[model samples]
Target: MNDRESKSKILWTLFKSMFMLSACTFGGGFVIVSLMKKKFVEELNWIEEEEMLDITAITQSSPGPLPVNASVIIGYRMCGITGSIVAVLGTIIPPMVIISIISLFYTEFRTNKYIAIALQVMRAGVAAVIFDVVIKLAQNVLKTKRALYISMMIVAFIATYLFGVSAMLIILVCLGIGIIDLIINLKRIERSAE
Candidate 1:
């Protein structure tokens, strides 16, 4: 196919993939992230695994919803602003449609025993999915074998889970540290090249 045609096809594919993933996904952004890693990283080989992890970290640290942040990044990477809009629309539309439909049945659905039971079951499933995400992400971080990072992760987990320390605080501190590390590394490289 011609360049324009090929690009169009790829955009369409990205749109369709995001739409389908959003439609079927029940948990939330983390689940969508895992699936995206599987699809774009493992299956399609469109992005590297480390890059996907970086994308996930960036999306999570940002202010917006994870899926939206992810869509924006992925789409921009693939095509540009047009692709980003298409991707965000695809990621959002499914939930909007589902919510619209559910709103029509709000009263009945609220009173439905089966739905309550199903929701309880779904809570367990969601927990499992979240746990899986945690494990995978932790493993990825731990693999780098940086004692400082490993210690920080452990301390951060303890602070958040046990002591109720604010996550935003942790993220901000880590962000500062990362910047410092980058600056130091660059200076070291320059010194070595002298």
Candidate 2:
């Protein structure tokens, strides 16, 4: 295809992929994130696994909803601002429409035994997906083999799970550490060059 045609094709594919993933994903952003990694990093080869991990970290630490945050970054990485807009629309539309419909029939849905049972069952699946994502993230962190990174991961988990510390606090602490590590690495590089 020509340049214009190829760009159009990519945009279309991006929209379609996001829409389908959003429509099918039931649990939340974390669940969808793993699926996105598979689709974008593994299948499409559009994004690197390391980049996806970074995206996951960024989206988790950001203010808004995780899926929307991820959509913005991933879309921007792929096709700039237009891609971000398209991705966000695709990500939001399905949940918005579904929730609207659910609200309309809220009473009926709440009263229905089968729907309740189905939702309860879905929670188990969601837990599994979340667990898988956790394992993958931990593996990535471990691969770095940096004592500080590994220790921070364990400490953060302990602080969150055991102490019930605020996630925002943990994220901020991690960000500070990351910045220090970056600076240290830069200094080391400078010294080596000199």
Candidate 3:
């Protein structure tokens, strides 16, 4: 672990980290997530790797955008509500500013020949970045070495990909299974004490 950083230092680090992560990454939430993990978990050593993975999962399962969700969770974990507010602002401001500028010239941007080509190239890059996120997520899951999780992962994949089942259903089913597992473990612990 690194030496304890002061409150102001931590807040500044959180803001700068999120700003840089959000500003430069073009592919989207997943790309931002990958970069965030590298900076916060790997480089800065601010967050634990497993906790980072948990944050990723939570962000994915939440309603809003993953990067925003992650920033809020991580910031709160590190420095409480104030940190969360700052981190969220950092993440939001850049994209908001960029979109506002782009929207000003939306018609011209849409009609321009070179812009269309650049958009096509960006799409390809985004695809690659998404693929990288998938592989990284799978590796994290595999590291857990839990058969139930792996089976659930495969079932979720097959359900969504092959049969075209709704992802919401799969998520609900997994939620039920997790709750049941918790109940069963609690019962077993009680029976052992008796």
On TM-score, the candidate that comes out on top is: 2
What's the TM-score of every candidate structure? 0.95, 0.97, 0.89
The list of candidate 1 runs beyond 4 A from truth reads none
What would the per-residue lDDT of candidate 3 be over residues 69-99, giving only the tens digit for each residue? 9999989988899889989999999999999
Instruction: Write candidate 2's Cα lDDT for 32-104 as tens digits.
Output: 9999999899999999999999999999999998889999999999889999999999899999999999999
Better of 1 and 3 by lDDT: 1
Which predicted model would earn the best lDDT? 2
lDDT of 1 by residue, 1-194 (tens): 99899889879988998999899888889999988888888887878989999999899899988999999999888889988998899999999999999999999999999999998998898788889889988998899998878888898899999999998898998888889988998999999999
Q: Quick one: ranking by TM-score, best first?
A: 2, 1, 3
lDDT of 1: 0.90
Q: Which pairs of residues clash in candidate 2, taking residues 3 or more apart in a chain or in different chains?
A: none
Candidate 1 vs candidate 2, TM-score winner: 2
TM-score of 1: 0.95
